[model samples]
Target: MTRTALRICPLCEATCGLTVTLDGDRITAARGDRDDVFSKGFVCPKGASFGELDADPDRLTRPLVRRDGVLTEATWDEAFAAVQAGLRPVVEAHGPDSPKFSASLEQGGTPIAVVLGNPNVHTVAGALYPPVLLAGLRSRSVFTASTVDQMPKHVSSGLLYGDPLAIPVPDLDRTDHLLIIGANPMDSNGSLCTAPDFPGRIRALRRRGGRLTVIDPRRTRTAKLADEHLAIRPGTDALLLFAMVHVLFEEGLVDLGERAAHVVQADEVERLAAGFTPETVAGPCDLPAASVRRLARELAAADSAAVYGRIGASTVEFGTLTSWLVDVLAVLTGNLDRPGGLMFPLSATGAAPRPAGPGRGFALGRWRSRVSRHPEAKSELPIAALAEEIDTPGEGRVRAVVAIAANPVLSVPDGDRLDAALASLDFMVSVDPYLNETSRHADVVLPPPPPSRGAHFDYAFNALAVRNQVRYTRPVLPLADGQPDECAIHARLILCLGGQDGADPALVDAMVIDTVLGKAVADPHSPVHGRQPDGLAAQLTGRDGAERRLDMMLRLGPYGEGFGADPEGLSLARLLDHPHGIDLGPLTPRIPALLRTPSGAVELCPAPIAAEAERLRGRLGAVPDGLLLVGRRHLRSNNSWLHNVPALMGGSNRCTVQVHPEDAARLGLTDGEPARLKGDGGEVEVPVEITDTVRPGVVSLPHGWGHDRPGTRLGVAAADPGVNVNQLNAGRLLDPLSGTAVLNGLPILLTPVR
Candidate 1:
């Protein structure tokens, strides 16, 4: 029998609604849900091919355990037993007498319990359970994809607003002038800032007489849609933005408007930016002095404007400074919190709006890593430092690792070193669907059921979405016989960490519910105040612990029904009735109310940010010598994980080094010929792709490649395995403030292969 089911695409940040057709456990087709409230029938290539991804033959169906140095299939019970045996010692060893775990006791519990979170942490059980597990372990040794991708933005937001999670998204639907720097939303479908049809939004912006300006090394797909595109030098985003600030102050175009009362350090910003005039930074940025001033004028003169930057502005030596200046421009132009300007999203599941007042300010470097002493940012150690924490022998060395949907070997910088570091670990476990580069090193590999068999919710992406909307997707297909729910697997893993291997996984969920309900009932502001926790637990509705937890979150959320207090507000049952989704309307301005700083206002120039700006100012005259390297994005790809899907394998997504025609001619490089490229980390011979899109002094390589690692099971990916760009980084260079790997603006030596 054939049946159609509606679900949300879990592949990327867009979180578009998917209409999947299944015939007896096999996914046949996937298309856009026309009635979807947020996406509005928009489906990207990844969403359209969800069926093939869900039914990939290479996806493991059973748990695997390492026996005598070999991975072999094992029963679920055997896998749990093995995990309990492996991880229990690390969790129990808390005292300094335990030589195996000697991390600083002052920071937290033993540093033995470590976790590596992937981008997928935004979806599925990954969003729900991993935090619980980490909280239960109480370990300071944690790593996530954020450090490598978006940590700078988080740190910048934390410095400006007291909360690290309070990030602002561009009001794409209403903005009149959009200035995009170092991001290609057409390919990424918008990252950090989430929008379903980013390309469509750009087109609509053009139709509405809105001006779009893109500043990047290459003229990406997003840039092509812009009214103007500036092929700027890589890694000079901070310099360019600072120069823009200079022009704003010098030309008397600085307008804080309604933000005057809510903003601080305007004079400090002017003093800091005074030295970075357009003429001073034009040479390094490869842009004319006139162009820089004109851009500032356009931004300030526009009725509404938003300055947005992504991975390109981040993952650099001055990443944190660039991120901070992006918001500084928005504020200086009076676009921080207004219609057709940059604003914060009010998610349905987010905390209820609190009275704007002095709050506990955000802090950094609370704890330092053992070997390098790199300070922790937002409670996560830099992914760039994970190798040394595991390999270096000391009091705080990582003895065991728990990776959830992560592939640090391929994702992080210096894969060769991290690969060797994993081998030396006493034990490692990976909760992933594929046994690729990173998971291959695990002692036990637990594969979660495919997306079709699991429910969907965007706990993370929803908070970053351009619009305020809510959606849910029930399982499109039933769980296979004898297969366990992904949530159950996570719960069992938590139980194992807690030294109860064979216990019912449901107990883990129950304990969480009890703890949450107990806290809620005791909170004076809670709607259920004075109500018994046991009574509320009985009133919860769901088929399992995961859904029940969702129900609880929805009931307690800002737009929630408040347990019958507001009958028409959101609830799990209401979401179930509206399968496509419920449009909550467009983003509204949230300023003083969203500010959580100790000052109850936006801190324009924090000390740390000011110090970093000085560092950027010092580099205003220093010029980059060689052809700088930057990364590119392909619409067909979403990091290294998605290349294996046959439906998305071909077309313009092939891996190659993109070099500007002028640079190719100057270096005697030929198109379609391999070229030797060496950087601070290492070297690789990649085929040259000659194009005029990139600036003359810059070359581009798409990240998330190098599927050629041995002992992997990605059939399609390995066949055409591309070279790893991270290998060229050598893992030494990093952004000092954010500790993010410097993935872009790296100087490299290039020679054509004869």
Candidate 2:
């Protein structure tokens, strides 16, 4: 029998709707869901290859336990028993902090450490269960992929709005002018800002008379379609942005519009930016002074404009400063919180609108890592420091680890060190679907069932979506024999880690529901405030504990029914009724209510942010001279995750260094030949793709390669194992504020491999 099922693609941040053609339980084909309210009829290559990826022969179907120091297939019960035997001793005897990626490590009674990967936010269980698992384990500390990816943006948003989660995205559909720095939405499908069919949207913008400008070292696909491509010097984004700011202030273009009443410290920003004029920074940024002035002038003159930046800007020396300046430009031009500019996306699952007022402003550096002494931001230690934190023997050294859907061995910097550190752990477990680079070192590996056997939801991406919307899908296929859904894997894992190994998995969900409902009823502003927790629990509905938990959340969410408070509002039942998903409409201005600063106003010139300008000013006119390394994104790949899938491995997805013809000639490098690219940490000899896409002094390598480790079972990835670009990262260079690894815009040496 052939049947069609609707599912939101979990491959990337775009979160487009997908319609799968299933033959019985097997997914035969997948295509864009034309009726989807938000994504319309758009599906990227990643989405199209969903069936192949889900049915990859490399996917582990059973748990593997290390017996006699060798990983062998094991039953779920045996896996759980191994987990209990492994982690309990580490928690009781050695303590959990293991030297502090987590502040609770000092308090110690929980698990040693838990590291989450980028894929966690992509699924239902991933989005909901991680917090529960961490909280239940009293996890001394938690490390997420944020430290290596988007932490700077969170830090900057925290300092600006007094709430780290109060991030603003460019109004993509309506904007008149878009200045994109270090981002290739056409390739990435948008990160931080989630919008499906990003390339089509860009095309739409162009057709609608909107202008798009890109500022990056390499002319990415998005840049090729741009009105102007400013190939600025690597790691000098902050300097170029500051130059624009100086131009805005110099030309008297600092208009705050409605923001004038709520914005503070404009004069401070002006004084700070005074030193980074176009002329002063032109020599450093490798961009012309005239171009910088023109960019600033165009932004101010545009009917509506926005500045959107990504990893290229955030993974640099002044990541937080650069991120701050991106928004600073938006605000100065009176474009912030305005239509066709930047606006806060309010998800259906987000809290309802409230009057603007004082809030508990976000703070950083509550505690420091015991080993590196790196201050914490949003409770995350620098991922680049994970290897050192584990290998450095000291009080509270991490004796055990739990890695969920993460392959840090390839994702983070200095993989060789992390790989060695993982081997040294007293005990480690990985909740992964593949025996890949990182999980191969685990004492026990529990594989979650295929995506077809798991329900889908976009809890995290909803808030980041360009348009407000809600969507949900049940499992497209029943779980195979002995297979457990991801939610069950998580719930059972938490139980085992917490020393309640045989307890009912339902207990985990019940405890979480009670905890949330109990807190909600206590909050005076909550719709269910003063409502009995038991009563609320009884009102929830779902097929299992996970779904029931989802029901509870939706009932309590912003657009939720409030358990009858608003009968027509959102609920799990409501989402189930709309298989194609419900569109909640476009984004709107969220100013006073969105600001969480102590003053209940936008803090334009935060002191910590202002302090960075002086450091940036110190580098004025000091031009960089070397072949710098930067990472590129391909339309077919998303980090290291998709490489193992054969369908996604060809075309432009191959791992090779992109070098300009000018730089190649200088280095005596030939197209299709090999080059030894050396960096602070190490070096790798990779094939050179000579092109003029990149600037004269820079080189580009795609992130997430290096599948050549022994004992790994990735047949496709390991066959031609591409080199790991992150190997060149020393893991020491970090943004002073965010601790994000300098993944891009760093000086490196490139020589022809003779």
Candidate 3:
């Protein structure tokens, strides 16, 4: 028996570097790898608990199948056969499009071959998959967490810069002033901007004579660190941003000439913003007119300032508009793409690529749900409509489904409704690690091996990271007997369902070898490379001689005659040599140069957003005496994943209705008392935590809890299962443009549950 030190971290999108302490054959402890360049030894509480995930007693060690309405431990063959039998018919009848697969971005062992075998598999990170996978699916019905959160960034970037992937990263390191709206980067660990150790970054900014401001309804973790915190009303972010821009234009504070060359619809944006003066929109957003104007002036006067907005702004009724206006403010202030301002990622591929199409906004009825008429994005209806599509009888109905890693019944809007829909499916198969929540409804459950057994790539996170860097995670251990890898299980499913035999064994072997060797070549110290080698070039050419051209070019490129094997240059071997991680460098602004619009200018005030102005004003007029429900995020939870991890679930799991003390008194409720929240879908009784952290007339709840699944072995999470907030959320209300479920900003009635 021997012990070895390994560096790996796969907790969330942050991908912090980790040092695993091993004792013989067991992992004794985990700590942050201080020498890592990207994270710089930063590790979150979640990442520190990797040992628990590995040793959890409830972890599925073998496959399981439901027979006679009871789940029984079974062999891998039995499980695969059951899944194949159940899903084959669905593939035959509806084609691959009907059998949608949803998996988490971090799940291990998902077979790329199986995923690519069928065009129907839907992943949250579909944008990062290989070209073969993307080309095969070919349908607009695809739905993702992006539309519900960061679609605004994509849409705005595309409209203004001509490149959707050209999203701006807030250069916190160099920024003199940073304004964060509707976000808490401290807890989220920098959403859409992968900055590890965010707390330290904020502290450094303040230490360097920089200022930080947070505009949020709650005194979030990030707010506590801010130089100033503005408690604005929920769902009113767009208004606040508009007022900021309005003040900039009205007070002669804006440097229009600075941005004149890059701005596309500057005149249109100026005219539109004029209507949203601080005085007019301040009342709706519950902010003082003076504060709005002062903030706008501060932003405009700053030598370099960037306004960052995320989830809170993108998951509302006017998400697209709010997203659009945030960018408008950045551009109008002459900070759209500048150092110490909003900067773009310098990608290996130049820019984030999008699916080729009309390049217009979301369209309706291009493909509708068989039962609910819910608009389709690619070939799939929104997850919110999954239940109706399965239960309703009509042409193109979803009679069966093959879910991958995703627990939609718990994660989607209207959980109770989705559970019922899962029950109605003619056949259901789940490729997951546990028979919890959504998988309990499946006829067969195919579990993949643990994370340590899978090769890791941050394809999706790379596109969103604040800096440009790429790293691959190689499995630290070999697969155990009687269990198949994620890729193998997925491949089996695709082959069985498509009535096709498994891929050539040689091809499979070659792909696996390529992936492993490519990862090693990216490192600077692999045996194949006598010394340090450029991993990116290795990855590009690790295959049969095809990547040789790329390797030759990199060897001759200006960066160096040969891939510098040192930390100063870019190469995988160098990255591996130093386990701590390497800093790729700060992000730089790339707006007009990356803009793809016909006029080669940023579309500041696009027509689609302009046409909705009257409607926005009308909605702004109706915001009186209404309680808007919003969702909050915590560091401990990774949506539905961490509930089963004991260390993270030691405390409370019960959902809390965060109401302002004023609202609590007004509703005759007290802190820690039961409160009934009623909505169109249903009502749920949750405990109340009255705190001024929440603005008056607004209520908050952390999403992805309330696990009521029977036979689930998660003792910790089950001990204090929270109420499902989605049960009190309406599925009908959605962003018209993105068709993203409006998870926040629903008007609901609250009563004391007694």
Candidate 4:
């Protein structure tokens, strides 16, 4: 029988609500849920193609073990055994037969590397399991997709707010003016800043007579909608932002408003930005000095304004500086923590706000990569260094890798090198649904069941959401006979990696519950403080361990009931009762109460940020004359993930390099003609589309293509496999503060292929 069910789309950061039509156990169709509180009725192409993705046929339903030299189907027990065998060598101190897995590792064992992908935070398994698994292993070697994408934002936030996770999103519905730099939220559905129907929100801002300004090298979908679009030179966002800051201070327009009490170092910021006057940065940014001054005056004159910068700002040489300046602009304009400005969203599951005081602030460089000695940011070594860490002979080389929902081969820089590096690995294991680029090298591939058969929760997205809300969805269909749910798959992986193979998976959840509840009761800030852990453990409600963990977290969260301490407060049971979602309301001001910095105020002029600014001051007018390269995104594609979905790979999503008409004419390039683009790493020959949308000395290439790997099962992607844009990246260039790959504003050469 066919039925309908509601689900929260985990395809992207938008986190739209989906109403799925199921025919028996198969998903037949998926559309937007009109009743959804956060997303409303907005659904993008990725959400609409859910059925095709869930039934791709190429998705592996069974585990595969590399028996001898060939991969073959294997039982769950055999698959996990193979994983244990492969991981055992990496953790020499703890063998598969070790009795005390967690305790033995407390003293610190040999490093076991782990790489988590962006998709992990979308599911309960990814959100709840990895931390526990890492703890069980006690390995310090860590890498994640964040290092290649959004690490700069996290680093900047840590330096500004003391907590790396304390990122602020613009209050789109109320802002009077929004300055967007290096971001195309209309296509990305917003990253770091999460909002459903992002384009619609931008349109709504215009409808309300609010002004929008875009800073990019090319005219993007969001840029076209702006009141004015400034095609700034690539990698010069730091210069542009600091120039605006200089204007804000120069014209006596420094208004911190009520947040002045919670923000410090205004004079320090003004003094540091003094060298980056509009006239000085105009040459580097390739924009008119008058335009830069006008933009600053507009922001200062607006009733309320927000400056939002994204990947374009984060994946460049001065990424952290650009990110920090985005917020500094907001703070200087009296928009830091006010309504109709950039403010932090308080999710239902966030830790209850602690008393405002000095806190344990964020720190970096506690660890470094062995090969490059790249300092750690957010406890993650750069993924760009993964290849050398494996191929190079060293004492603490990454002998084995636990890749969870990650595909670094096609996603990160220098894919060719990493592809060859994987062949030399001692052993590898991947928790993935497809034998794709990175997973094909794994000794064991454990595929989680389809999304239809897995429960849904917004563990990470909720914290980054533009609106304060909560939603939960049960599994649309039950798991098949021998299939394990996502949670069960992760729990099993944890057990096998912990050297306690065949242990009851339930123990993983039980131990987590005991530890969390035990700690919550001890902390005076928790609502459940002074409560007996054993008594509250029996009171949690859920059908499985994952749900039970969610229940515990919800009960102890900011909006949660303290084990009946607050009767009407949030509980998993109450959230379940509301089918659509519980709207916790719009973002409110959270200033000194949320400040965790050592000084109990926002660090307006962090030392590292100031140093980066002074570094930019040295290159005020020295812009690269050669063509610079930057990446672009499409509404239907999300970095290499959606290319396999045939329905989402049409029209504007095709692979081609965009060049300005003037540059194309000079290089003898034409529309639909192949062009050779060379970079520091290597060269790629892609079809050129000459257009004036891009500025004269810049070219735009989309990321997440080049799906021509031989072992992958993505039939559609391989049919017209595009060139991997990342091939041009040698993995040498990185943002010093955050270690994020400098994927944008890199010097490149272009010529007609002839």
Pairwise TM-score winner, candidates 1 and 3:
1
Q: What TM-score, to 2 decimals, does candidate 1 have?
A: 0.98
Which window of ten consecutive residues has the lowest lDDT sum in model 1? 100-109
Give the per-residue lDDT digits (tens) of candidate 1, residues 239-336.
99999999999999999988889998899999999889999999989899999999999999999999999999999899999999999999999999
TM-score of 4: 0.97
lDDT by residue (1-754, candidate 4, tens digit) is: 8989999898999999999999888888999999999999899999999988888888898999998888899999899888877776556554324443344333222346788998898888999999998777766668899988989989999989999999999998899999999999989999988899999999999999999999999899899999999999999998988988999899999999998988889999989988788998889898999999999999999999989899998899999989888899999999988988899999888888888898777887776777788888987889899888887774666678899999999889999999998877888899999888899998899999888889899888898888899999998888889898888888988888767788988899999999999999999988878989999999999998988898888888889887898999898999999989999999998887787889999989888887877787889869678889999999989888778888898799989999998999898898998999888778999999888889999999999998888888888888878899899989898998899999999999999997
Each prediction's whole-model lDDT (CA): 0.88, 0.88, 0.66, 0.88
Residue range 243-297, candidate 3, lDDT tens digits = 8888887888877545566666677777887778788887788899899999999
lDDT of 2 by residue, 1-754 (tens): 9999888899999999999999877789999999999888899889999999999999999999999999999999999999999987665554443444244455322337789999999988898888887765555456789988899999999999998888899999999999999999989999999999989989999999999999999889999999999999889999888888999889898899887888988899999988888988889887888999999999999999989999899988899999999999988999999899988998877776667898788787776676777778887778887887788876656668899999999999999999999999989999999999999999999999888889988888899888989898898889998887899899989888678889998998999899989998998878898989999999889999989988887888878899899999999988899998888889988898878898899999887788778887889968878878999898889888898888888898988999888878878989998999999889999999998899988899999999999999899999878899999988888888888888887889999988
Q: Candidate 4 clash total?
A: 0
**Which ranges in model 1 have alpha carbons more than 4 Å from their true place?**
95-103, 106-113
Could you give me the TM-score of model 2 versus the true structure?
A: 0.97
Screening candidate 2 with a backbone cut-off below 3 angstroms (N, C-alpha, C), the clashing residue pairs are: 98-396, 98-397, 98-398, 99-396, 102-141
Candidates in order, TM-scores: namely 0.98, 0.97, 0.85, 0.97
